[model samples]
Each structure stands twice: as C-alpha cells, then as structure tokens.
Target: MSEPGTPRTQRLRHEAETAAARFPALLAEAQIIAASVVHGTHGRRRPGSGETFWEYRHYRREDAASAIDWRRSARGDQLFVRETEWEAANAVHLWRDGGAGMALASPGRPLKRDRAAVCLMALASLLSRGGERIAALGETGRARAGRTGLERTLHALAEGPGSTRAIEAPELPRHARVVLASDFLDPPETTAARLSALTAAGAEGALLRIVDPAEEDFPFTGRTRFRDPGLGANLLFGRAETARDAYRGLWREHGAALGDVARKAGFTLITHRTDRPAASAVLSLYQAIAGLR
Candidate 1:
C-alpha cells in the first residue's frame, strides 16, 4: 500500500471523499423512507428445516467440514449447515441503473434516477438493520452486515454502472439474492435476460422499475418535444395528443411483456412511479426478497 501524501494515496482519498459526498441528502432521505416503511416478520419456511434454537441451510462445497451439522445431515440425504438468524439472508446483491435516461424528470417531480437511488438505498438500510450481508454487483469487496455493509454498498453504487444498457452480472454462489433498480426502459427481452443473469446461480431475484408519471400517463397535449438523454435524440410533436392512444397501447404491451418475462424467469418485478410513495415500493420489494409478501 502507498504511504499517505503519495499520489496513489491522494487518489484513494479523493475516491472515498467523492463516494461519501455523492449522496448525503439522498442517503438521508432513503434512511427516513426505510425507517417509516411497515416491515413484517419473516416466516420460517424455505432454505432450512423448520425448527427452533438454530437455523439450518443446505451445505455448499465452500462450507468447512467443521461447519456441517452431521446429526442433521444423518436425518436426511442432504448435508445441512447450521447458522444463526444473522447469517441466513446475507447473500444479497443490490444494483441501480446509472444511465443518463434515468436523470429525466417532469417539471414538478424528482428525477427517475433519484427515486431509484432512494429506493435502492432505503432497501439497503432496511436489510442492514437485520444483519443481512449486502454487496453491490461487480464489487470485489466482501459482502458485509449492518452499517458498514450499507456504506460499502453505497460507495460501490456511487461509482456508477456507466451508460450502457447491457449489464454485467457477476458470478455469485448458490442461494444468493439480488435486487436491481432501474427504469428498465430497454426492450423487454433484453431487460429480462439481463435480470435473469443475476440469479443464474439459483439465487432469488427482484426488479424495481422506476417510472416517470408523465411516461405512464402521457399527459402532454398540443406541441411537445421529447428528448432521449442517453442517445441525444429529440422528437418534436405538433399534436402530442394524437399519439396518446398508440403510446398507451405500446406502454401497456411493454409492461405486460416485462411481467411475463419476470414470471418465466422466476423473478419478482415491482414498478414505481416517481409520483408515488417510495415507502410502499421499498416495503413491497423488501417483503418480496425477504419472503414476507
């Protein structure tokens, strides 16, 4: 490691500062939302023998022989590894879209990107309180629990995923869970495939699609201009109302297709508009991942 005052040290310091500075207000808002959301108790159902005193998980190859509960294993063909409640749901990866299009907002609304970030951070805050291990997609850092886990995840998220629509889903171990937040305005097939990749290891997964109310409602009439921030393309409409019926039809079809894809891939998809309450989306998403909903 480089010593303090060196160029490398300066760069590292700058990075940390930048990450810490990127989302102070956003992080605070997220925590507030998280704190207010109504959380329910998780049921004792999957991933282990329904029992008391200790939780049991299926033994993975990475587990040490010492960690295996041989008595439990002898009761069944499958090997069982025992753990506390703290260790049961830590294999979670969280992602948010950093594309330019996510920056769009209506005149009186918050940005889609901002809402998505808030929802993602709020979920992280909520999960961290449960001692769940949280990691960011593509992060090399080990997943951690509690406050430090939230900080680590936020730092990774601040680095942004770039402007590409294509996602890079890192390899993860079995039983991991992933929650991804984005506008998901891409073609339904593309979005579905990318999301499915997050759970390729038999992990559970969820999608939170952020939307602008204007996009959903098509409230524009008369002359209107639309811009694609990502592609730098613009469209001017003389009578935007004329396209309302077609736009609504296409929008519904797209949503349906996305829902179907998520169903087939065994993933849960939650759509939230910037005009809606972040707490509701966060609550639903948290429940979905925690198996409480």
Candidate 2:
C-alpha cells in the first residue's frame, strides 16, 4: 500500500486511473436518468428517431430493420438510415474552483475539495466518453482537451494551491451544460448572482458544495488553533463544548442560505462531505443534471 504524503507525481497517477475507471458505471446510470428527461443538446438520438435527417449510406448488416427508408431505397443502389440533428452531442463545461478554502483537509481520508475534484473529473470523463465535448476550467483559467485531458485535469486540480483570487462567474456558450465543484465558502449572494447570470445566458448549471465532516459537526474539543486555509490566518479556539451550539447554528444557517439561493437560481445543489465515498456524490450530481434536461 502507498504511504500518505508520498510524492503526488507517483501516487496521483494511480489514483486518477482508479477513479477514472469508475466513470463508466456512473455514466450508465446517468444515461438511464437522461432517457426520461426532456431532450437537451447533450442528448443522444434513439438511433432511429428524429426529423432533420443525417446523411445515409449503404445499409450495414447491423442496421435496424425499421431504419430502412423505402423511398430512398428505390432511388439508390444501396439503402441507408438517417439520424437527427438532436441526436448529436453537446458540449459540457466542467468548472472547478481551486480556491484555498477547497484545499482544507478533512480529519480522515480524502480532503473535502480533493474528493470533489475527483468526482467532477470522473463525471467529465463519462460525459466526454459519451461523445460530448468537455472543457475543464480551474480558478486561473480553462483547459480544453489535451493528450490525456481527463487525467491532466485531475492532476491539475490536485496540485492546485487553491484560489486566493475572488470568484468570478464565467461566460459559457449558449446551450452548454456546466458542472461547478467548489466549497462555496464565498459570499452566497455573489455566488448566487453569478449562477443566475449563467442561467440567464442559456447555460445549465449545477453546484457541488464540498464540506468537511469536522466543519459540519464541530467536533473540535479543548483549546485548538483554527486556521483560515485561504488567508493563512490562525486563531486559538477554546473548548468545543462552550461554543458548540453557536458554531452548529451558524453552520446550519449558512447551509440553509446557500441552499435557498441555489434553488431560486434554478441550479441544482448537491452537498458532499469528505468522509463519504465520492461515487455517491457523483451519482447524485448526474441525477440532478439529468433531471434538468
């Protein structure tokens, strides 16, 4: 077994491969969910259904019997089937926040933001494999397909120092689908407004808010140092019991506010904790995106 804190170059490659392998199963489920939703630009054709016909060629042995057009058959030496424009794949934008807050480590297992990155990358791989064009963006800027784009995206995310820069909403292409993976510790109002703008511009958006189990439950006890990962500021904390209620209350309030804003903006919000398996969170996000279609 690999030891913790091993050189990321050696260890991360194996991890990325393992996580990428899980994408196929998750995508299978996503396709099933998408089948019942409204058809969007990202949707694939039913193989024989649609109107704006695609080009036809000589019929292949595996061509569906129902796809043969008798009229076209009469005029041609060979018969072929038509595909609809709607069946063509659409582009997907996988935008992840690399801000400092996202780098905070959970008490155990994968760090909160790192886990979210993995989930997003896996989901992106699935989308790309399904024929959709995928563009991945971090806080600094965006990266399109590379020799191994999915792996590169995952590596970049894991190695990122986290964003010190303010969050800005990116202008996406019309009819494009976006998946944002972030801690969302920034001002809820600003974040909400950015998301609303994206929606207004004809882009569909979803948020995966990553949180640490410790932050959610406030399990800290005795005098402890609390540090701001983004700002690099630290403060000494007293016994957890004394401020437990207040901390929990504030956490809940923040979560509620974030949820409300996301709902009002017409974006799906999925909350993920560091302690949980990323697979479940990825599945939930896929389901939500599928629902939007």
Kindly give the number of clashing pairs for every candidate: 1, 4
lDDT of candidate 2 over 1-293, digit per residue (tens): 66676786667978778656654544453344344322332533134333765454455454467868778888867785553443322545676676667657864556565566677766665554444445554332322333355555554444443442322445443455677778888778877777776677567768899888888888878998888986789978777568889989988888898999888877788998878766677767766765654
Which TM-score value belongs to model 1?
Answer: 0.75
Candidate 2: stretches off by over 4 Å: 1-89, 138-169
Model 2 TM-score, all chains together = 0.65
Query: Which residue pairs collide, candidate 1?
Result: 90-133
- The candidate scoring highest on lDDT is 1
Per-residue lDDT for 136-217 in model 1, tens only?
7655244566677778787556555623332455555456687878888889878767756655755677889899999999
lDDT (CA) per prediction: 0.75, 0.63
TM-score of each: 0.75, 0.65
User: Global lDDT for candidate 2?
Assistant: 0.63
Model 1 bad stretches (over 4 Å):
1-22, 38-89, 162-167
